[model samples]
Target: MSVKSAAAKLFAKKIYKKTQGWSSNPIASQKNVLNSLIKEAKKTQFGIDHHFDQIKTFEDFAVQVPIRDYEDLKPYVEKVVKGEENILWKGKPLYFAKTSGTTSGAKYIPLTKESMPYHIEAARNAILHYIHETGNADFVDGKMIFLQGSPILEEKHGIKFGRLSGIVAHFVPKYLQKNRMPSWETNCIEDWETKIDAIVEETFEENMTVISGIPSWVQMYFERLQQKGEKTVGEIFKNFNLFIYGGVNYEPYRAKFENLIGRKVDSIELFPASEGFFAYQDSQKEKGMLLLLNAGIFYEFVKSDDFFSDKPRRYTIGEVELGVNYVLIISTNAGLWGYNIGDTVQFTSLKPYRIIVSGRIKHYISAFGEHVIGKEVECALQEAMEGTNARVNEFTVAPQISPLSGLPYHEWFIEFENEPDDQAIFKEALDNAMRKQNMYYDDLIVGNILQKVVITKVVKNGFQDYMKSIGKLGGQNKIPRLSNDRNIVEVLNIK
Candidate 1:
């Protein structure tokens, strides 16, 4: 092993013991995090207004604050944007993770001095745990590529601001700087297409071992690499073995990725957002990412089914149950309280609190009461792809309630790198799998209320074209897996 790899393994061993200590007592860790957050923010304007001084227990905290999405909390955020200190967080934010698609155009989530280190630490621990579990740390010695937005930042009211991924680029450890790929000048390229092209040119012959990004954007990178070298990505970068990703489920894209790389690679799933780094895959054997309990954030869960009800009960770490889909709410050191980031998660392991992201609460289909979620759709599609040569590049489903003919149906817009040998049979398999996974969908099929799914084969680069039309071609953006409306499919087919 290289000296760096040996050092990495030793550090991993030290941290693995520390991880086990707190992970073993999750409730206590959560309680301590909640107390610290409340105590630190108590003197802030928001803390005073919400009576944080009187909050002593989870119950007291819950009663003092109510669930609020970005729109509801924008007033305080505006204060911070105008150079105000101790408005939402304890002091002015170090940076704003600017993101698109709020009721108001762009959201500026605070990244406080107290909360930022945990994001970097969570990412580090994920790799460390991988080393501890597998006894492999050689990837640290090879080139690592992180396909992300430009590392450039824009100045705001006394704060630096940019995309979350971009902001994180500034914090990459000095030890890894030489191994990080796609030179800084290339990373600073503003346009994603141009950036990827530059990246392909820079790293195609380099000894890349780890590549991290959202799957869709990384898929574009792989396609470009394939076109340039006329070979599988694995052939081009023989050392590449670890694939790290977030933002969307990888099951639907797994087969396609395997085909592109010419082999299977171990992957780590991360649950990170502008608000906080919530979880990371700590074990290759486990099914879900480990929930972060002591990361300067307190979590709350309201059952997804009851989320929109007049009064949905919030459950803390000790109060949660396994296998229940819950809309995740968080109160963090950055001063977001009773905040709903719109993600829904299901507990897979309660011992150390592992969770699988179920879907986004807003990004699902219940058009005919079928109520299909992102995870179910991804699983069903993966199930159907078994024993078939069918491969998907990307896909999205939308309800076709007022079709031109016969019964209403679900329309699937797919861009395929390789068409199935039997298209009609593949469509049937897709519908059958959907039915098997969801009883509501089965009822809709049997009752003749909805026809089997209709497949609309999107043209090559069709999804890319649609995204380009909207100016969101890459960088942590993805098409929703399922939509209740035809807004996506209507434009997707046009592209």
Candidate 2:
């Protein structure tokens, strides 16, 4: 083995030893992390306002700090933007990770010197854990290409603001800088299409072994390479073996990716958001990501079913149960206390605290009380595509309320890479899959309260065109899989 590969293997072993204790005793590990966070932020304004000194336990902390979403915490965030010190964290934050907003324009999540290391460490440990488990360290000897957002950050009152991926790119370890693709100049191009063309031109012949990005964008890159050389991605980049992806579900795109690569490769899923790095796929044998219990973020869960209630019951890590859908609440070193980032997750395994991302709290279809989530839609699509040659390029689901001449129904706008042979049968299969998964939907159909789901085969690249028109074409910007209303569908001009 080469010296770099041997050194990476040793480092992977050390990371495994350091992180294994959290799996052995998750509750204790979480408590220690929480205590450390509380102690560290005790002098901040939020800390003093919440009486942090009097809080000695999770229960105390919970009762003192009510759950808050972005709007609830916006005032303090504004203060921080205007150069306020100790408003949320100790001193001022180094940067703000801007994310899409639900009702507001945009959200700027704080990124402090103390919290930045946690993001960097979690990404490093994800790779190290994969290496330790698989004994594959040769990837370290080759280049890595990460498709990220533009790194040219805008400044507001002396604070930097940009996409999370862009901000994290600025902190890529100096050692890895030599092997990372898409030079800083290319990464700073704001237009994704222009940026991706530049990236393709630069890294087409590099010895790339690891490629990381959201699955959709990465798929776009792969398609571009195929068009350029008239060869499969595996043929073009023979050394590529590891595929790291997050920011979206990979199931719907898995078949398309495998087809593009012309083979299967090792894959890992991560649960990193603008808020913090929460989980990583530690073991290939496991179905879900292992929650980072010892990370700087302290975790809490509220049953997703009860989230709309006036007072939802909150569960600590010790109280979370397997298979229950829960909305995650977190208090992190970045000074977000009891904050709900709006993503919902399910505990797939409790022993090691493994979880699956269920959906977003705001992204669901309940127009006629079906209450379907992203997980259900993804699974239904996966099942419908089975035993067929159909491959999804992109899709979105919305309720068709006030139809001109029929009962209300769910509308699916699907763009396919390869259209199914029988469109009618495909539509029926999709409806049946959804009915089988959601009892409420089945009952509504049986009771004649709702019509059958309407499937619209969109023109190729229709969804992409829509995203581009809205100036949200790449880097964590995704078409909402489920919308409670038809606002998105209307904008897409899907009658």
Candidate 3:
């Protein structure tokens, strides 16, 4: 190995070991560490004007940098997309991550040198968790299947460049480069229509031990695998052990993947965006994840109520109350300060900084006019799945408006493990769970909001097929579960 590669590996190992047991929970340790880090950041020229240096207390940081959504940074993103220097960071950014959000009119977040390390390190931690989970850390660690986006960016008026994924691929360390699946790294897709085809062809070629990317894309790959009559991982790559997913909930697509692989592949959850990788699945234990606070950002959470209420109070890692749902906010070295990423998560524990992604503050269904968050849907699904051979791989609830009452009704499309003989019981259980968990749903069912729940059993790989149709097959990709707009629902053929 070259000296740089050797040193990189050594450094990675050392940091992992040093921080591994520092505290059973990294969450409790964040306050002191953050306060100290802020103190040190103040010493830097960048943090000086940013007020990181001036803020001593948590309240000070909160007051100094108010909570900001993506809309707040549109002008900054425009500048970054135009390749302007010093819009949010010191140097020219490597690339812009283009992401679509509800309130933000298209975001192109800048990824700078100072902020890249956080993403790299957090992602590395996610891998470590996978290694621990599969207990196959020593397995043929030859190549990892990233299943990520290629760099083929579209600029204004035919002025195009490689996409951010392509740019990041080039910048990844060389040693790690060899570890990536050739299919994921290669920019072969010429357009959106061919992207899924290119990805499906690539995935079948390797003995991918560690698979990473969005669940929706992964599901599409597996759907293609099955369509080709490939049944088991051993049939393609015998040593495959892990499935790393993030960007969106995998609940809808999880079962099909497990059953098709015919092996319990270790699963890892990652919290990443165009901005940076924030937290990752610490599969070393159960429930909650180890937040990568030390990465190129300082993290904060505001209670879900506070995030939506007229008065919102932000809480530091140390200040987070256990079991309460909060919206994630981060101030990164990449120049995104006090940015609310719109994810709703709750602390399962405080010591290690483990959290559960409850739902998106914006990504909920209440078209029936009854507010239903992701957590409520998850609970209802879990309850509904009880006493049946059926297991839901992935699911989404769309509200269908009634012409007569002009009220919204919920239509559930679920991908099941095994198609149940009796659908009515399952539907009843789901309804009962919904009414129990959400008073709004109860009110709707009893009165005027939404009259009844409509349940549909799709082909085991229905969601996967939808993703393939969309041509978004890999990398930081996920199908939105609850979109306010009907375009996605109609396209997916969800009733």
Candidate 4:
């Protein structure tokens, strides 16, 4: 067995022992967890003065800090930038998590030591859960590759800081440290190009056993491997066993990786963002992800339909019902009290509190005046692909608007496992399916009010390569499945 695997096993045992009897009932046990965190935050240098005064109950938090989007916290973040104390985070803010922004240029999210551990703990829990569910931990012995963001330090106008990704990478277990693969850091908010290149050069041809990151970035890495004359992913990393993906959906890109590698790799999904790691798919059955409810935060769920109501009722972890779609609101040590991260999720089960990412509240395609979410798009794509010999390897849906035409219409960029003869038929079926499910789509199609829906076939890995070219290829990287505007669509203009 590889030394890394042995160490991981040892750590796993320790983790199990530490969390032993810590509640098999996920919901019933969260109150105790939240209480402990609230106490800890009060003790932290940053959280002392701001020890949650109004957050008594989970519902109390919802009422205290009304469900807020990122914009709601912008003013506070600006205060942090001005060196204000007790605004965004307490203590000297360690650094900002430079994140991808849709409307803004790029977000510099401040992080504090009080809340940094939440991200680390969430990751640790994810690792533990993966081992517990798969039991592959017993047999598998290989190096793990983290297809992560840059680990470089940045100095913006004399303020010195490194990326939060860099900080996390720095603290990984010393033994398995050799397993991290090198990635380019050209535009990395940090200018550690030389050091980053050195790290990658040292690990070339090493025994990389598991790979994890954004599906798109991982695809880019595989393409880079191909350019280096490596015929298959397995050939490049002969010891690989696990592939973990996060930030965006992996369903569309799954087949391409399997085909290129010529073997099936165990896959896991992580629901992580610049804010924190929230969900993890550790189970082998590919069920819903388990959440990190107690990692320096208190979580509340509000029914998505009830969001704009005068009195929106929120549910605690224990009170949440199964099969209901809810918008997640969080109160974290980072001074975000009942902050809404914009993603919508549905509870699949109650035992371990398993939930599926339904879609983003902001991410929708209403081009034809039909509001369609991520889940709806996923359903439409699945229905269209059913019974078809050709499997959809990857896809992006957007609304194309032309000033001359004066109306916008649906457009899809589809990548198939194998080219199909009847491309028109596939597009027709998908459009028909979407219209049947969404009344807005049905009206547009029946009245011929908007431009006809169109699908364009791209070479395999086309979009993946496009994202990589822009240096966005990892867990925090975003690939929108639905867009009603042309601004985001233009990002895909690359060949």
Off by over 4 Å in 2: 364-495
For candidate 1, the lDDT comes to: 0.87
| All candidates: TM-score | 0.76, 0.76, 0.66, 0.67
Runs off by more than 4 Å, candidate 1? 364-495
Clashes of 4: 1
Quality of model 4 by C-alpha lDDT: 0.64
- Candidate 3 on 126-158: residue-level lDDT in tens? 665454444455433446766655655656422
RMSD of 3: 14.3
Q: For model 2, how does the per-residue alpha-carbon lDDT over 119-158 read when each residue is reduced to its tens digit?
A: 9899889999999999998989899998887788899888
Ranking by TM-score: 1, 2, 4, 3
lDDT of 3 at 50: 63
Q: Per-residue lDDT for 430-467 in model 1, tens only? A: 99988877765775576465789988889988888888
Worst 10 residues of 3 by lDDT: 156-165
The predicted structure with the larger lDDT, 1 or 3, is 1
**lDDT of each prediction vs. the true structure?**
0.87, 0.85, 0.65, 0.64
Between candidates 1 and 3, name the one with more favorable TM-score. Answer: 1
